[model samples]
Target chain A: MELTIKQKKKIRRAAIFTALLLFVLVWLLPVFGALLTSFRTMDDLMNNGFWRMPEKITFKNFGTAWSEGRLNRYLLNSFIITIPSLIGTLALSSMVGFALAKYKFKGNMALYLMFVAGMLIPFQILLIPVFKLSNELGIYNSYWGLIMIHLVFQMGFCSFFLRNYMITIPDELSEAARIDGASEFRIFYQIYLPLSKPALAALGTLEFTWIFNDYIWALVLLRDDKLKPVTAGLATLKGNFITSWSVLVAGAILATLPTIFVFIFLQKYFIKGLTMGSGK
Target chain B: MKRKFVPWMFLLLPLILYTIWVIAPTIYTFYLSFTEWDGLTSPQFIGLENYKYLFDDPTFYKSLINNLKWLIIFLAFPVVVGLFLAMLLSQDIKWARGFKASIYSPMILAPVVIGLIWSWIYQPQGGLLNNTLTYIGLKSLTRGWLSNPETALYAVIGAAVWRHTGYVMLLFLAGLTSISPTVIEASKIDGASAWQRFRFIILPLLKPTTVIVIVITMIQSLRAFDFVSMMTRGGPFNSTNVLAFYMYSEAFRNYNMGYGAAIAVILFLIMFVFIALYLRQIRKGELE
Candidate 1:
């Protein structure tokens, strides 16, 4: 059974293709199971088990998850917290980034290292202190507290990312703006910010997903059920409906929509932002 | 003086917010670790007592071992699988785009969502896993995966690995793109075997990406709190406990803020070692 060289190559290609298909199917099975479970009635799930085809499909779970589960209010709280955190984080970090990138002042390198190091530290250390601080400031259990913590804690990564990005912009534009007596703030706003659009867009998309998917911070700071964001709120729903697999799965799926949409539509920016500093 | 002051002006607000929120709290947590405060009282300084109790605690040892297990599994499974997937996709294969998208989609979902999905799959009585096993005549193998003490941590780690493999693959894909094709072609023309080319050329070139992957995975293992909290809550007699989740339970559930702070300090130190190594790598890369 002597095979031609081209035949050998075709066989190899087909083997690799089959391997990839198998891997993807296994990788996606959990998600598929969840989806299947989401549409089945409690009776169907109980009778058929999770691996079996549903006896009857239902849309009532999504409706129950939305209203009775209070997912509608939680979704609104998520938006309120995530949007402000995203905008404030970018705004503050871009300023610090501009200064560090464009200027060579005393403690410049030290400040940059501080941010890079701070961003990497496990945040569990700050849990108790942050909880108390929020309480003292009278912002505990409010959207403002979670928003502020997110804004500050996220600044380190955002600043480090933006500074690395802004460093690549030509210095001559800022130099010319400086010569024409443009204020530092004006120069940043007018020239550098606009020039850094691609970086901002990429970072904005990444930050949105991270902020929206936040559970730990919201769990710690927001005790009021009405104030919890979608992720934390979903956990409560899980607790309430532990026996009701369909409703719990429905809430989980609903909570996942925003980030999934971001990943699908703005995938290019998301990958670019994530892989920015890692690759050459 | 005016020129010098302008940069500070730009940095002022962020610096203020960062210091107040992040730096000060971190420093205070260090101080709190030394005191006997219930988070409500003025602290009584009881230096070294928390550390003393922690040193003898069985659960701490269990958690440390579990965390090490997580680190070992992540370093082995996801890194290898991710690199393999990236290598296959880098070929001129059809439907590569579709495969990449489907694999990477899990990374976008909230950990809560991922936890819920896997919870259903690992559910004891009518779980996907148990049902499939029974159907295939392996009924003896089926057990309550998440409820069994021996299997709980590994079961949760499997879910985490599922969510993380695509991220590692994407980074490697980026690293693969940066490699010059002429280098691979040159090896092929010289009659290099595929394995030989990978060993000699591709592996050496991918060092930076590998370092990044290893560091991120190590840190992620330390931060494996979310899934543990979501899936098992360190249950089945605390068999699945990790350092981060232990710290949370100690601080909030028991109101043992001081003891929790000490545990947090330990986690921070372990993670700090990796962060330092990563930063050094970044610095060397910048120099080059």
Candidate 2:
């Protein structure tokens, strides 16, 4: 039987919808399992398993994790590291990016390429040297040490991002400001910096999430328990709550919340950043 | 006078921090790779002795092979799924936004969290996968996934793909959205099949994006660390060891800084070639 146009469209739409539904379910199952497991009590978890819905949904695991687990401290370290690193990176990268993007000068390509190549190296290679260097700088096991590492490493990608971003802003605005009495720094401070807010905020969100979720860096650098970021702190959770699956899952969920909020709320900016950062 | 130095002044902070923390350390790693040190005391230069040791180490071959396996699996699975999903999502559909967000949510989680979640699911006894297998009467298939050398790496790769595929889809979707609708419409009017139209018109246009997906996935696979380290720690006779983990274990755990640095330098060279090729591509594009 020859299919009518409406029928064919309907069939195709059904297929598309089914495929998308299946993909989303498959992708989200592990996430849902973790969330479901977090809500369950250990008793239920031991008896019924992680796949089943909780017999009694409870938030006590979150309470225990926050207080007894000292997740609060880890979350605090996350902010201490993420905030200054964010501000410094944004400030430094945009300044450097503005220079590279707008200026025509000698060594421009080389300088820009240096930043680009800096990003391409496997950062783990720098682990030994960076560890030793931080120790020498007398900042080992300190919050500032991790912050400095985050800032320097992120500069490459951030500069590259801001430079590319700043390029797209019509050169006219900066040129007009240059023609005026405004200094180049003033132009950047007043004009280009404000204009690049969207890129800045997006990169800031990504940078925050990244440094927050950093495992190896925190594991290597921070020796003090109080200074451990949430990611490193979560690894420690496994040792304390070896049998308490619920508490560990709850902690993981807590560790994930800020990034999740940033992701869902500032999704467009996040996607834009990801797309712009496609090749890396 | 301030204006004369303002740009350089701006360059100063980033340059100082970056050079001291990043550039110098990177270059020093090369020299350190030749010398024996425990991250302390005086260094004794041994000159390719570390690399020679790495070459003869059987575990090095195992880890290298696993990395290649990971690279191959990632290149195949995530790229294909991402492209298909990107195409699927780009089509006008109800709740596409919701579906897109749902699919991409995993990307927001820490790799450790992803690893933790999957590890539970893959548990051999009373775990999600084994339970489901028993329910479906595939009870014979159930085994300790992380402890099983043969299945361990592939199982970890599956988790990596789960996180990566969504990221890949998002990139492809961004690229797909920019294509002119007229090109698609014109092909449709010419009685071309969907596959034919995609092959002829869409694929070529997506060259830039395809380059991105290939390059990024390759780099990600090569740099695979957190998932493997968190989930398996290169266990079950080091079957799942990748260069990054092996390098990390050597440096921090064993204090074989020189050997680890050597491993890292080799990994760097492999990645640098790709980075150079990518840079060349960008320069060519600029000329166009």
Candidate 3:
């Protein structure tokens, strides 16, 4: 008995579905463990172990993690750090991106290459130098210092991405605006900026997540616990809450919520930004 | 005149910031590599001394070798698996968005969170991994995966690969989406087998994406500090030390700023090769 083409296609689809289902489950096992463990009490983990289901679920960890673990403050710091950095990055990068995309000048490619390559430059080299520079500049251990670094350092990647994106925007629009006697800055503000919203929104989400989750910069640059962003703060919680698995894991989850939220909300733009920059 | 000047007006602030924070520091790192500085005092000139010391340091060699190991494994595993997953998801499969969201969720989590999550999984006693091993009656295979020197680096690498696969998949999915469907349909009408079509058509067309993926992966492997720092801190006797972590520990922990700068210089030089290739690719269009 030969199977019909539709039947064969159906069978093949089912097979692919099952295979993907199995693979995704395996891939997500660690996350599932963290999520499950976050809901259980320490006693439950101690008695049942990390592999088993919780005997009694608890939600107190979230409350305690927020108030006691100092995650609330850290989360606030993350927002404080990320929002300004995001705004600054967008403003600076968009301008540079526009300049690089719209202008014809000596050292244009050189400037563009500098930004792109700077994005990929190893941070290890900048670690000590930036730390020293920050201290020398009287901005050490301050939110502004970290915010400044994030904005400046991220400008390279953001400008690079936005430049690639802006290049695809037809030149005729800008040229038409120029012939209308509009000033360059006015044309940028009115026309190019509006057109660049998708790219800006994409870069905004990416930069927000990156600056919010940054651990290395926050660790070396800031000294005060109150100044630490969620990533660095949660790491400190890991050490301080050595015996409390629930609170630590809860804090970890809480720390990721903002970025996760941004990712979910701006997912379309996020992926678009990523694919756009990859030379698609 | 006004046209040329207008672009510079836009470029001024970013250029100043980039030069100060990125370019100057990069140049200073190279200069610092040739001197001895404790980071508190002035750096004293000692040309090539740090490099000579790095050449003779066993830990440096270990870290270099470990970085190579990381690069090789990353290229082999995540890139391959990501491409496979991308291809699978690209076939008009059901619930592709849900699956993609699930797979790509880990990439959004901070390295600290990922580190802690994997620690729970790799914990020797009552940890998920060991318990699963024991549940299936392979208790002998279960041991302290992270505490053991032999498995520490590999174990950390395993966790990193988990976080990285989704990113690679996202990249490949983008690449796959841009591929024109007419070409594939034509090949299929000619009775090309799935394997033949992929090999002869899809693979050849995906060269640009492949270049980007390989370069990005290589650079990422070189920057493999976060997971190592979060999980092991180059521990079990520095068995997991990559160059980035080693440099951090040396400069920050031990106050060997000059030595750390030298290590950074070396890492930068290694990354420069891939960066150059990537730039060459981008330059082909020349912002047209």
How many backbone collisions does model 1 have?
0
Interface RMSD of each: 1.4, 1.9, 1.3
lDDT of 3 by residue, B1-288 (tens): 666688899988788888888889999999999999998889999999999999999999999999999999999999999999999999889999999988888888888788887877788875779878987889999999999999999999998998888888999999888899999999999999999999999999998899999999999999988899888999898899999999999999999999999999999999999999999888875644
- Evaluated with lDDT, which candidate comes out highest? 1
Measured as a fraction from 0 to 1, the native contacts recovered by model 1 come to 0.79
Chain B global fold similarity (TM-score) for predicted model 2 against the true chain B: 0.96
- Candidate 2 structure quality by residue, lDDT tens digits, B38-109: 877877899989999989999889989999999999989899988998898899887999998887778888
Q: Quantify all predictions' global Cα lDDT against the true fold.
A: 0.90, 0.85, 0.89
Candidate 1: residue pairs that collide: none
- Relative to the true structure, candidate 2 reaches a TM of 0.97
Is model 2 an incorrect, acceptable, medium or high docking prediction?
medium
* Candidate 1, A43-108: lDDT as tens digits: 887787666667888999999999999999999999999999999999999999999999989998
Question: Which lDDT tens digits does candidate 3 get at residues A181-274?
Answer: 8899988889888998888888887777788878899988999999889888888887888777778788888998998898989998877766
The estimated TM-scores of all candidates read 0.98, 0.97, 0.98
Number of colliding residue pairs in model 3: 0
Candidates arranged by DockQ, highest first? 3, 1, 2
